[model samples]
Structures are given as C-alpha cells and as structure tokens.
Target: MELVTHSPGDGVYPPTGDYAHAIEVRGAERLVFLAGTMGLDPSGVPGATLDDQLVLIWSNIRVILASAGMTVDNIVRLTSYLRDASYAGANAKARVEALGGRVVPTTAIVAQTLDSEWLIEIEVTAAS
Candidate 1:
C-alpha cells in the first residue's frame, strides 16, 4: 500500500486541508470506485446532526472499503457533494479525522440537493 503524493514547490500553493495537490499510484493491481454514499446508518436512519452525519458517512466508506479487502490507505481520491457550502469547515475537520490526516486528493461541490434529505454525499476511488 504505497501512494505517491505531489506537492509542487512552484507557483501552485499547497493544499491546506486533508488532501494533496495530486496522487499517483504505481503498479496498482486493483482499483475500486464506490457509489455516491449517503450518511445513513445500518438502520437506515440519518444522523441528527451534521458532525454525526459526517462521522457516519466515513464509517460507511470504511465498510465499503473493507468489503473490497482495502482500507482508507488504499483510497487515492474522493469527491464530495455538500448540500450547504457553509459546512466546509466542519466537513474538512471531519475529513481530517476520518483519514487520520492522510493526504487524499479531494474535490467538493455544493449541490442544490441530494437524492434524499442527506446533508452530504461522498464517492471514493481506491487502488490496491
């Protein structure tokens, strides 16, 4: 499980959150692209708060990765859909915690709404 991250010293500024400028995986034997995941628990109940939902969302990602015999370290990139752009701070904090500060390339877009009443949705791409 080795990934190469690039943070150029040139004009491009370094990323300030739990992400890298870019990542490259060499000799990856397998790759997985997960569906856009919502923050619903096993019981199908959404979290009561934004932070709780964010935590549960990552937990959901973990489960999906585990099913493929992979872990967070195998994740190379993620795209997030946020219902509200104002949650960026809390979202970034949650992301840092979820990845244990690992630098994964990420892109966040503010969507008008998700499939359901979800406050956030995330999709991940992993390699192994």
Candidate 2:
C-alpha cells in the first residue's frame, strides 16, 4: 500500500514531528470506516487525561483493523474530535508513537466533541 501526504499553503504546518496532511491508499479491494471511538477502556472506565485517551483510542483502532485483516498501516485517514484543540500537537505525537511512526494517516483535529466529559474521539478509514 502507498501512503500519501501534502501540505497546502493555506494550512498551518503540523507541529514538529507530525504532518499537516492526509494519507491515501491505492489499489485496495475493500475499505472500512470505523465509527468514532471514545476514550473508554475495555472495562468502560474513562481515561484520565488526553494522552491516556489517545493511547486507548489508538489501541482500539488497532484491534478493529486487525479484526478486518488489516493493520495500522492500512489506515488512510484519521479525524480526531478533541475537547480542546490546544492538545493537538501532543496528542498527535502520542498517536505517531503508538502507530510506530510509520502510518501517517491524514488527520484533522477539531475542537469540541459529542460529550463534554470526553477528551477525545477518533474515527478512521482503512483499506485492505
């Protein structure tokens, strides 16, 4: 699979170590779009902080991808809904580390989420 990224002149550069872009995967036979995942752990406990939430979300994404016979590398896009956009840089860095620095899905971070108590929500699109 091929990953695609770009930096448009109108957009701010992603914080250091991250890309302000999206990834595109070509020649895939099937695609999957995951529902937005919240910060709940397997037992339904909420993560204590934004970073914790990010880790849990990425882990959940990995599980979902595996179930579909794909890996994190197959993910083409990630849209994160965050309670506060100020946390984007640190959260993005955490995500890159979680994904092993190889899968750079096109990402968008937005302020505000469906619930006030949720620090972050992540939705992904993948192919296989």
Candidate 3:
C-alpha cells in the first residue's frame, strides 16, 4: 500500500513527536479498525505496572495486525488513553518502539481513571 503523510507546510517548525499531522492512503485494498486493547499477559492477567502494560498492549496490537496481514507501517491512526497523565513519557517511548519510527497520525488522552487493572488502552486504524 502507498501512504502519504502530511504536516504543516507553513514553513514553521513541527512538534517533537512520533506522529504525522495526517496520513493519506490511496486506494488502500484493506482497512482494519481495532478495538481498544489493554495490556495483559498470555494468561490473561493485566500487567502490574503501567510500563509493563504498555509493552503488552502494543504487542497485542502487533499480533492482531499481523493476523490481518498488516503491520504497524500500515497504521494510519493511533489513539491512546492513559489512566494517569504522568505516564506520557513511558507511553511515547513504548509507542516509538512499537512503530519502529513509522510516523502515523496519533492522538493520546489522559483519563482520571480507567479500570483498576488497566493503565493504558489503545485503539488502532490500519490500511494495506
């Protein structure tokens, strides 16, 4: 699949982040909308800490994407919700690792609370 990424063309400096302002896919043959995924182990146990869960969540998303014959490079959009605002750094680090430097359109929100067990949840939209 061919994808086009856009940022401001206004000659201004862009923000420091791993995301593109927007992503465009032309005639994408397939699209997948994944539901919000949270971190959990193979035994279906939620991670004890935010950092651990971040890795697990991304891992699960990768598996799901692979199952659909897609990869993180095919992701056009990513939305992440965090239970605590301070986890932003960890979140960004994990996301960068997960995307492997691919720039995708992304939004991240911090909620006052999620379920007691989940530190983060992520939703994805991919095309290939």
Residue range 18-112, candidate 1, lDDT tens digits: 78999989889999999988788999888878888898899999999999999887889998889999978888888878788898889899996
Best by TM-score: 1
Q: Each model's C-alpha lDDT?
A: 0.87, 0.74, 0.86
Clashes of each: 0, 2, 0
Model 3 Cα lDDT, one tens digit per residue, 1-128? 68888888688668566878888899998899999989988888999988889879988998999999888878889998888789888988888888898788888898754577888899999998
Looking at model 1, residue 102 earns an lDDT score of 91
lDDT score of residue 7 within candidate 1: 81
Candidate 3 lDDT (Cα, 0 to 1)? 0.86
Model 1: CA > 4 A from native = none
lDDT winner, 2 or 3? 3
Output the lDDT of residue 77, model 2.
Answer: 72
What's model 1's lDDT at 16? Answer: 73
Scored against the true structure, residue 90 in model 1 reaches a CA lDDT of 88
Q: Pick the winner on TM-score between candidates 1 and 3.
A: 1
Measured with C-alpha atoms, the lDDT of residue 54 in candidate 2 is 80
